[model samples]
Target: MKTIGRRMRFYRTIGAKLKGGEMAAILNISQGSYSDLEHDHAKPSSDTLIRYCTETDINIFWLLTGEGKMARPIGEVEKEKEENSEISIIWQNGMVVGNHQVDNDHKYLISLINTIQAAVNCGLGKEVILNYIAQLLSYTEVHFKREEEIQRSIKFNSLDEHKESHKRLLDQLISLRNEVGSAEPGEHQKAILEILFNDLTEWLFRHMLDEDLKMTEYFNLEKNHRVEDNSEE
Candidate 1:
């Protein structure tokens, strides 16, 4: 049933309980494209197919190859229910790392990550979780850029090392974002979600408490030295 018409119709029917706009939003596509998909006027993108499988109970393996059960089994449901352990708890004020602007950005990033965690912990819909992930990734790119700018301005001695670390986290975020947008659903998908979420949350803590603190300390020292030099003059 991989024929364009059959595949489109099958997926459309599966999601028929929801509005075309709603499904389109979940897949990050336009409503017109979703209608075209349902009518077989256009093909579903890999991301759309993946979102369908993720939001519905459809076994993506079967949807792709048509060789397995169409519906996921109860084991997945059990795993979903049990897998919500705190991925670094709620953000607290202790996370602040000095500079007001930088601290504000970190707070926003923390809120975004916390939203992602809430999605997993509260058994939120797959679409909701993915949306939060997208928000986190977008904001992270902005935050990292700003952080790097601050580092450059300060001429922080550790800037190179800090930038390298930022690159690694950016790579991880891009990889996870691509996987979430296109990977077929199953145990492996669930595992990817958990591992990536943990990776991101932990990175936030590490960067804020360690790397960011270093930047703060450097600026503080420079400011104090300038004060002492001015007083001596």
Candidate 2:
């Protein structure tokens, strides 16, 4: 764990250098505290660690074990592997309403999914993995709030059903975290990673396809009505 801490500090330094003060601000920590991380004098909280990875392209595996490249090197091999990999959320025009704001939020969700994929591939230790999950939970809360607001504005008849789906997702994610927390640290990493790759992926993919698609269609229909009414006027 001490070694992992050192490696984390190393990567944080490199990441801070790349992103400058914006990353530090997002984590809500001082430059001095971040400096302490780089210097190996201060251990970061799980929330802070998660925010660092969320804000930067640092390799989670390298940050833990100090074995792999700090970033996945760009190459034909990497590109081919990424292409072949099954993404958690399958993007479809039919699943997106073409509302710029909603679409942008969806894109951010995809980014978070991809980050989780990267973290899993990195084989980081339990603590680091948990930290990443915490960060995901925080961001998901904000995203859900925005999504529900949009649904309300449109008066989508299925808003209650959609909100229930979001609640279910939150419950499942929290349950997974609790289960991981109960396990011995060394044994927990693999189990949590498996859940992310299998259960979480399936949930996100199904939720978007089955539930979000309805919202998309509803918004599109409303948009078309306004356009038609304007033409008639």
Per-candidate local distance difference test: 0.63, 0.59
lDDT (tens digit, per residue) of candidate 2 on 121-159: 777666766776687678778877888998898888888
Candidate 1 positional error at 89, Å: 3.2
- Model 1, TM vs. native: 0.54
Error of 2 at 182 (Å): 2.8
Best by lDDT: 1
| Residue 28 accuracy (lDDT) in model 1 | 58
lDDT for each residue of candidate 1 in 138-173, tens digit (9 for 90 to 100): 888888889889888888888889888888887877
Lowest lDDT 10-mer window, candidate 2? 1-10
Q: Report the Cα RMSD per candidate.
A: 19.3, 19.0
Model 2: residues >4 Å from true position, as ranges? Answer: 1-94
lDDT for 62 in candidate 2 is: 55
